[model samples]
Target: MAELESPKMMPKSITFLSSLLQRVADSNDLHREFQPQKISVFHGLTRPTISIQSYLERIFKYANCSPSCFVVAYVYLDRFAQRQPSLPINSLNVHRLLITSVLVSAKFMDDMYYNNAYYARVGGISTIEMNYLEVDFLFGLGFNLNVTPNTFHTYCSYLQREMMQQPSLNLAESSLNLGRSLKVHLCFNEDETSHQQQQLAV
Candidate 1:
């Protein structure tokens, strides 16, 4: 497999994405405080000391995935939240969710990506736990890993719009509506590795 040739430095869009996700996760955590959702494999025993932005920056620095993977990872996160109401993005699970989503996105969307072991080290989890997280996340998403060009562009546009209208952006409201209209195709054969890598035009 050919290595991805993108620059290793974090992109500006990643900073925006991190901020947006942090806000969403924080909002969800506050809401779940009273409701108390069920804890699953994604949830950590305790919230990581590191902030979401810093964790994401760490992944960007080491994962070597293209910036587009972050957008697709966001898409996967939306789908997971929609599919699995029990496992919403909150303070406890947001970091793990971000790492797994980005790892899956890189595997599916990039021509080259690090293995689960490498991703595990980057995510501050054991390889065994990372494998479990990957499987659970895939099932949570119903194996809908493929993102259409339209869906990708829609998310990109949404992130860009949020960047411009940060003050007025209602994180919860916007997050709830994201990917609602975008169609996703499911892939059932997990062993089938062939994927057409699409270049994100954003």
Candidate 2:
């Protein structure tokens, strides 16, 4: 496993959600990147090999939450780390913060079936702290919670629809290949485009 960045990074965070509020009031800056219609969203960062680049990413592997939650959680975590670097936190506290952040984001962004009250009750944190964390998270993500992306289910849906038309491609490995092919098929002769292709190809 790749070593994770230490929780000490929390202190290095930018900590000014209030100051940057004007820059991303609606967080349109972040939403411009999320494309829900695409297929095989994280093909390069396959579930089996994703690194702990973000607290949410690290916890999702351990928590078994849905992809929507992961997406919200990751952006929130990154934005928080980006903004408030002085907050004192260890790995455990960071995970707790991420869990609270994920639940809060999910509630706003998706149909999270889990009960927020139940999670907070079970979580070993004060309700006040949870509320504070949520506030920080909202400010970090520029108060924007809507995060949609191309998902595995979308890819499966595309494969099924295509298979119905062709009636020949097997849904086993061939479907996987189709997903891979779709990603690899994008021509990227430019340096920046090539770099993006490489990142997604990981």
Candidate 3:
């Protein structure tokens, strides 16, 4: 239930994720220039004028999902990349991919979320296109949306480790600890689910 807009979550976490994704997308786009790949539904005719960081910040501002959804969305992106190696994350596709992945993440991880049409508006795409992207994205992953606690922790740790490698970011120790804290929260939710089941039996 932790909002990404909270003062404690702002700037650092968002900046770290945006920078990380930008670096990946830029590198992939450069590689694709030399070695062309098959285009997927996620691709756009032209690269978005908006930067990855700004796009992510916009999503954070409006999506109203918990901070944890970003982490989960990153996991989904990685999974999709691994599953669909032919369609890599590049400049042309990254924006659409990001919007779809984050939207899917919010739907799966958060109890309260907006419809695809709302997310499509936030992503600057037509609702019809958003619907197409959602269906295609789900199939691309073969509907593997579940993230185990261990997988979640591993991704969180990987992201933190990547951030640590860049001293220029000057990320605080507390900020780095956010991943572990989120993992703990996930585990608590599992316990809560079990408690709900017990109450139902009573």
Q: Which candidate has the top score in TM-score?
A: 1
**lDDT by residue for model 2 over 35-130, one digit each (tens)?**
232221111222222212343334443333455454445455444544543331222234455466667766766654456544554443456756
Return the candidate ranking by TM-score, descending. Answer: 1, 3, 2
Comparing 1 with 3 on lDDT, the higher-scoring candidate is 1
Q: Candidates sorted by lDDT, descending order?
A: 1, 3, 2
On residues 1-202, what C-alpha lDDT tens digit does candidate 1 reach at each position? 2344754667767788888777767777767756547889888898899999999988988898888999899889878877876666788898999999999999999999999999998899999999999999999989999987766766777667657767456666654465322112121211222232233222
In the range 95-174, model 3's lDDT, one tens digit per residue, is 89889999999999999999998899889999999999999999988999998775666667666766677634322233
| Shift of residue 73 alpha carbon in model 2, Å | 0.8
Off by over 4 Å in 1: 1-8, 173-202
Residue 15 lDDT (model 3): 69
Cand. 1 TM to true fold: 0.80
TM-scores for the candidates: 0.80, 0.38, 0.77
RMSD of 2: 18.0
Please, what's the RMSD in Å of model 3?
9.4
Compute the lDDT of residue 75 as modeled in candidate 2: 50
lDDT of 3: 0.74
Which parts of model 3 have CA positions greater than 4 angstroms off? 1-11, 167-202
